[model samples]
Target: MDKNLRIGIAVLALVGFGALIYSSNSKQARQIAASATQAPATQASAVGRAIVEVKVPEFEGKAVLGQLAYVAKCASCHGENAVGQVGVAPPLVHKIYEPSHHGDMAFVMAAKNGVRSHHWTFGNMPPVDGITDAEVGTIIAYVRTLQRANGIY
Candidate 1:
């Protein structure tokens, strides 16, 4: 083929590839936005004598997976066994971290984004990237298990 023809073909291929990438990214963004809109209820409260349900992150039976996630993302500062790394982190296996207090949504938000340390001297928690929201669910489950085992109920 002539040099001009070859260059034209190359340019066309590049444009096609770019379009493909843009479309894929746009599709993913849309899906993510849609799912977030459909996310479950994340809060609850008591109304008079009846208990009101709230929308929050639900781990249910993913405790083991959450534990693995904790190992990968939280263990560094939280300690391998949730015992807290001296002054670096706080103990997660106690009453303070109980579901009623910390809640799954809180954990999910903290993992998805980072948490600002309102009470701790650690300042702010840097975001733990690479771990997906599902992984965050797993981690929360595991932390709940730990709390249960530690007599937090």
Candidate 2:
């Protein structure tokens, strides 16, 4: 082939490859957007919640372990230190959470059985699996201490 023809073919191949990459990337982006829109109520609710600043004092014993478990398990939607997600999850540090109304047992029940949305618009609180009742108790202890510090008692 003539030199000019060879160069033209090379340019076309490069252009074709570039187009292929761009097309693939665009399709993947659209797919991600679609999946997000179709996400399960639980997932969408969790993602909708915003990340917030979390501050907690020193803790000991079970409460300390509870904090670890909470961070690993509930911090996603509940917000760190149980600060809460406005539309996604209710704040655990609020006055409404006083033991008088939402007893410690409530936490256990919710963790085990999942609770329907009532207080906040965040769909439903799905039952968290793989965590024992005792661990739930520790998490409640951590939450209660935080609540008391924030004047929830």
Candidate 3:
């Protein structure tokens, strides 16, 4: 084989081996590392020290939990994978409808406040019952994963 081809194959092998090792640990660890680069910016601490960012505990290894929450709470109108079901909701698996515009805090508010019908007649999403803030965070994380996987981010 050519020198370039040999080097490429070696790199691929190394990457594959690394992925295997990462997977063998905990699932949440993999998700955190996978999305570490996409984490949001941090603010200064009260004591002039760098404030440590906290990731939700139950959502630590539970990317699927986000998907499940989306399906249960949002899929009816938002559709599976957040691509929009019928004329009910909008696609969220891209960089367009992002947290920057409709983000973590916004989602929490919307879930609690229920916005007016933006583009559909399906009444606003009433304040969600029984869902916690952490679950909302997980759903956002999972959607971010989809956006990344789809090359939207």
Q: Candidate 3, 89: how far from true, in Å?
A: 2.0
Q: What is the lDDT of every predicted structure here?
A: 0.65, 0.76, 0.59
Error of 3 at 106 (Å): 1.2
Ten contiguous residues minimizing lDDT sum, candidate 3? 45-54
Give the C-alpha lDDT of model 3.
0.59
Q: What is the lDDT of residue 51 in candidate 3?
A: 16
- Per-residue CA lDDT of model 3 for 14-55, tens digit only, reads 999999887775465444333322223452222122111212
Off by over 4 Å in 2: 1-55
For every model shown, the clashing-pair count is 9, 0, 2
Error of 1 at 46 (Å): 43
* lDDT, model 3, position 2: 100
Off by over 4 Å in 3: 1-60, 118-123
Off by over 4 Å in 1: 1-61
User: By descending lDDT, how would the candidates be arranged?
Assistant: 2, 1, 3
Q: Which one wins by lDDT: 1 or 3?
A: 1
If scored against the real structure, what TM-score would every candidate get? 0.57, 0.63, 0.51
